[model samples]
Target: MKKSIKNLFYFCLPLLIIYVGLEIFLHSLDYEPKTKNEYLEKNKNNLEILILGASQTERAINPEFLDFNSINLAASSQGIYPNFCLFKYFAPKLPKLKIVVLGMPFNAPNTPKEYTSPIVNHLNLAFYNVNTFGRATMPQDYLLFHSNQDYFSSRIQNYFRDGNYSNLNKFGYDTTRFYGAYQAANYNIGKINKSEIHIENEHNSKAIHNNARYLKKIIRSCKERNIKVVLYSSPTHFLYNEMRDTNLVYERDSLVKNLMEEYENLYFFNDEDNSGFEADLFYNANHLNPIGAKKASSNLKTFISKIIDNPKSF
Candidate 1:
């Protein structure tokens, strides 16, 4: 029996060593969270603006286009709860932070935790030591390779195959362009998954309310510091926009409006309906490509300036 146990341990030792080596190798590479982590660690005190939300705002705003010292902490599949948690953790570190721009995607107010992938949570823990999972995190939570084997495998494979480290730019923006069919029939076909359906079900009352509470918490946090809060919705393809449920979207807009009326430092920039981004500008039906991001970033810059320049004019 002892010999059998010893043989099993010996056989698994090499596999364990290989896994540890891969984890170290993955950590050494640059990624969105890794890049953002390093930058904030070095320059958080000088930061004047911080952008948080999911992919929509992540792809829309480019810190390079802004005049202020800014950082984009947004990532794809980032939930409102995680956004609130991140802001709560970093707000004190940013002495010069004057504005917080939150991208209000259709699902922002009711984004489910299930919608937030294990990889998103893993990256948050691995890079920032943040527990976006809303519980006491374990050691494995901070592991890039152990958190999600599929994600780690793909990342490692892609890294070796193409010598690529990340899909994000220096400011954590995804610059990948949309190259697939963009018609109404093909709009976000594969991207629309269980999360989308779960959010639209209208039966998730608890999650919806919790999301609102977290959002208000973020707004209040900024207001207490005399920092401005901008809850903006970037442009979505008209076809994708047209498919949204009127009631759900209106509820989200109403919540934002009410919050604006309730808070002195809150502002809402309604580009979701007004900004018409052409097909060439979209990386997907819901996200903008590099060129579109540049244009959007410029417009956002102007918006921020106008509001800050004359607070009452907005």
Candidate 2:
């Protein structure tokens, strides 16, 4: 029995080492979808503007719509943590960075603590230990022992099946749908019943507190580096506005207003005041369609221009 156990352990040790080494190698490489390095390589020193947030910002700002070179580093379901990581990575690279537009969603404040990307953590670790061969061992352990092997196998199988992993550019910007603005519009905000508004508000408030802390840190860091930070909320459909009215208008507005007052460099663009825009402009209650994104971008450009022209007025 002792000899059998020893043989089994010896057999598995080689497989364990190989798995860990592969995971570490993949982690060290700049391979994560929509990561900062990927964007930096494409945009480089030409990036005049940086847009950060979740999917809302991803879909809202199209670099083709503007004269300046812009890149959206937003990811789906990403909260302040990844945004902070992105800022830390890109801020130093962008010497000519003129503007940073942050899409401050209502849900940003409510992101759960465990919402970080496991993939991102691996990337960070690998990057941090780039010179050493053993740096990737940790991620390898995670892949071998902690992560779901079946899910990982499925991912690998699908990657080859769909040919997605073979094409790195597929994970890059999407020009057809304007980098996911069309998809954001498809997010259904009307599903929330009137009764659920209050519950969502209460939950969202807790998120807001978490959001506020991270936002404050981001703002402070930007200010220290002389980088301008614009805090803007994208236009939500009428139903979303109604939901906000039902539960979060006063609290949210007050929180934003206080931040604006505290930071002389911060600006807020609230779209709820305009009620005359066509409903077709919106894809849903929480996000704008392609046309709406264009309009919003135009308005933001004009707003930023005005701020540049008259710094004190902003």
Candidate 3:
């Protein structure tokens, strides 16, 4: 019995040591948590404007381009449910948070959208609240890592690499852009998963219900805090919509407009038909490159300045 106990200790000791070492290293490194963690630790105190969305907003909106003190909390592949959780997490900490600019992609209103990347989904899943990512709306990202070892290993290796903050300005804008790359042929309309599309079609009411719930949660949270919430759709190249379903875009805009009417604090900027995008302005079909981002940012600042100047109009 004593020999067995000694063997067990030897087996567990290295694992325990490795765990501790990893924890210490994670604290020291600028990995997945670094950007958001930095905002919480350093910028929360003085910030008035906060941006949230998927990668498009991360790349498009330069906080420096805006006149207000701002930070972009958008992450790649993040959805609205995660945005709500992030608001809940940060609202208490940021006493001065006055305005929240949330990116609403055309597909954002569609319910039960499958998370594209396991790593991104898992990272955001860490912020999941049972109330937000309930059984019906949320995909089981936790189970994905078990089936996809390569992706799981890649996620870990990415942590050890020096984070790509080169494109990221201090205000959390990712300045990376596909300059002069007219690669429209490479861009395609976002495809719906056949299986999930079937499921959504069958349970149409459930998808709509969850969509309303998540969107309202974000608006309500910000309303409670007296923070103005902007439902912003950043510009894309005219080719961006070439492959998309116009009916679907119309529905999303209608829903957003209805919500804006319902909530006094909520504002919507569709920008669907407003066009000035040349081939050089786009990184791909769905996102603007640096040149486009600059022009879009200038226009946004003008719009926001007017709104901020006349708070009563909203």
TM-score of each: 0.89, 0.69, 0.75
- Best-to-worst ranking by TM-score: 1, 3, 2
Candidate 1 local lDDT, 81-122, one digit each (tens): 888878988888999999999878765766676677788888
Better of 1 and 3 by TM-score: 1
Instruction: After the best TM-score superposition of candidate 3, give how far the Cα of residue 127 lies from its true spot, in angstroms.
Output: 9.7
Where is the poorest 10-residue window by lDDT in model 2? 127-136
How many clashes in each structure?
Answer: 0, 5, 0
Model 2: per-residue Cα lDDT over 1-314, one tens digit each: 99999999999999989877766544443243435456666667777777777666655555556656776666555567667666766777787787777877655566553454554343334432221122335535344224445645665566568744432232244433423322344434344344432213445556677778877887887777666787766666566566653335666667778988888777777654457544556654555656776777777677777766787886
Best by lDDT: 1
Model 1 residue 97 CA deviation (Å) reads 0.4
lDDT of 3 by residue, 64-169 (tens): 7787777777766666766666777766777898888888877666635344344555545433322223334354443334435686456567755845234555
Which stretch of 10 consecutive residues in model 1 shows the poorest summed lDDT? Answer: 192-201
Q: Rate the local accuracy (lDDT) of all candidates.
A: 0.79, 0.60, 0.64
Error of 2 at 91 (Å): 1.6
Evaluate model 1: give its lDDT. 0.79
